[model samples]
Target: MKKTLIAAFICSLSATPALAKTEIQFWHAMGGALGEKVEDVVAGFNASQNEYQVNASYRGNYNDTMTAAIAAFRSNQQPAIVQVYEVGTATMMAAEGAIYPTYQLMEEFSKGFDQSDYLSSVTGYYADQNGNMLSMPFNSSTPVLYYNKGAFAKAGLPDRGPATWAEMEEFGQKLLDAGYACGFTTAWQSWIHLENLSARHNVPFASKENGFGGTDAELQFNGPVQVAHIEKMGEWQKAGIFSYSGRTNEGSAKFYSEECGMYTESSAGYAGINANAQFEFGVSSLPYWDNAIETPQNTIIGGATLWTLRGHDDDAYRTVAAFYDYLSDPVVQADWHQFTGYLPITYSAIKLSEEQGFYEQNPGTDTSIKQMTSVEPTENSTGLRLGNFPQIRGIIDESLESVWNGTASAQEALDRAVSRGNEQLRRFERANR
Candidate 1:
């Protein structure tokens, strides 16, 4: 009887298993094809380790997801990680005691986290004045020009897109003469036409280091460079060379439909363009004003970063850090960049892609990289960090619409936008302070 009891106890002890991995919740706003890419990353991380499992929940668009996160945080149900758009940087930074700085989190949990591995242009946008990263740059992107090779051929223009604004206008005239309905169009009008325009020209878009310096930063986009560019775009509109197609990416439809010969949009527009456009297309550096400065400066980034939220236990935070380490892998970063058309966040990833000849096999894929990394980012070219940026973008959009509609001149519209946007900035400053 004693031997049988001992044998039963040994069998029960052998049947007992180890503790399950801690599951960490991650909330993001990626959807459609991009959402698929997010899932791919999560799957890779989950499979790479048995210590932690990351559960990604698709919240909605950037604004919607942010709202949900705020609500969740208020309710004490916040996830361990959340993806916030570039425009929301100020809001996240202002929410004291709400988020754990990713730099600190990594330091506590990941011995492998090295700031040097990250791309400077990417990290600059998400870093403090002292250059410490506040978040993990996941999907950084810059604007680029996309041209329809078929349309260019039909128009008897060079296969490559224009390098200067004058060349872009010339190509537009030829494209229009070739029976194309429009020569050029753009998505994210404010981002490409104004914010990035100022950066590329090494001009200030806002006071106080593009708003990173202090809450007192005010709009300065009403300057001569911005006015001249807007006026030129207006002239293009009057000549039927450029068409205003709504506020967002609605203009992209005009290009993919063959109505427009060229388009300026985010480098991340790759997947949609690849899947939707039937004609041959090529990507190139965004056109600059040849007379604006000697050469164009570095373009700023547009995309979201992963912020580690507070309220999570140490084990969960460690899991979040481990997941970030997995994400920082060169192979993983390269794959994400290739799949989504976003810039690789790490230098090692870019090098890995180059070694693999991904750029050679896929021409124009390196345009964003060259444009972003060719010049060391100056204070003016780093990025915008203004409060109420989404609202400010809306103000710029309305102002540009007035220009496109011929209701107001570029200078008049921009001056008005600056006036109105400054009011919002002051409001934000007061609230945050």
Candidate 2:
């Protein structure tokens, strides 16, 4: 009955006749304010022209959302478009019968589709072996440093966040001396510290092409550098220079609310900071080790994309592709980037933004794009593609938690995590094979 009500509501909403608008179901995980942004974009598209009517429904977060879609697909009721995180690339690819390639969808439906317009590193992570994109990159963002200007003032340090990890430690110590509650706190521990941290340092997160080219790779987190960094962070925790707020983004609220001095969060945090921060603040690229003179090769993107699933009728699939094309239009993409902190996905949109003086007016908004697209990008920092990555992230989080709680040393934590995570790798490999 609920499904019937939803279908009837969509049909009634679709009755307007400026042009014959085909209804396409879009299932996504964005909710609350972010979900409203998703709805607003769809409504704008519906109002722009009548060729397509996209009925978007709210699914949950990445893991719950993907699970729901896969179940619905088995029941022959999946939405045409599903928002999936980058980590799920390999799992979706291995499901050979389940998805339609974004590359083909663009060619068949959109009048002109150019892959060259997208940042190579961004699309490459979500593409097939032949460089054909599998999903429309949406909300792509990289990690950045978020610090409280007031806290820095109190600590008698420069208002700007540190550029290197050693400097950050020195700054943290001063904040501690000033009796600050915690010098720094971070969100998404594994993502910011272990995965992207390794990439920025040009350290391997795993062998076997970071678990992309093949899945026979074993985990390799027992390196001295990783241990040393983790150990230092652990020691800082004891000295009240660091705090473990939570395993999730709840840590973001702490830093923004002035409960902590520094935070490492997504570049997309710009919108939240703009809305909520009462103290002076600044954004900086993730700090690197001093020896990594060429550190921060690149920060990997952390967001979901629109994935076209199979089993939808041909016209429905075409409609999905058409909607994606509309979203990618230079004007629409630019508008979305301006309103939200998400990086513009297409080169044309970036240029359009620059021409409009968007970045010139808003300082630090371009820091993420500049940091990510600065270099040609080495293999170490290009991106990662591991199957069952959600589970692997959980494993890493557990290990990091162990370090924070003093239940184990940093080296021991990583060794055990590698052992457990490699077991997961083996499972994914066998299942895919």
TM-score per candidate, chains pooled? 0.96, 0.93
Cα misplacement distance, residue 38 of candidate 1 (Å)? 0.7
Deviation (Å) of 72 in candidate 2: 0.3
Q: Least lDDT summed over 10 consecutive residues: which range in candidate 2?
A: 290-299
Computed on alpha carbons, the lDDT of every model, listed in order, comes to 0.93, 0.84
lDDT of candidate 2 over 15-73, digit per residue (tens): 84544668988889888777888999899888887667899999888888899999999
Task: Give per-candidate clash totals.
Answer: 0, 0
Query: Tens-digit lDDT track for model 1 on 1-433?
Result: 9999999998888765454789989999999989988998999899998889999989999999998999999999999999999999998988869989888899899989999989989999989888989999988889999999999999999889999999999999999999999999999999899989999999999989898899899899999999999999999999989988988889889998999999999999988999999999999999999888888998999989999999989999999999999999999999999988999999999999999999998899899999999999988899989888889989999999999999999999999999999999999999998
Evaluated with lDDT, which candidate comes out highest?
A: 1
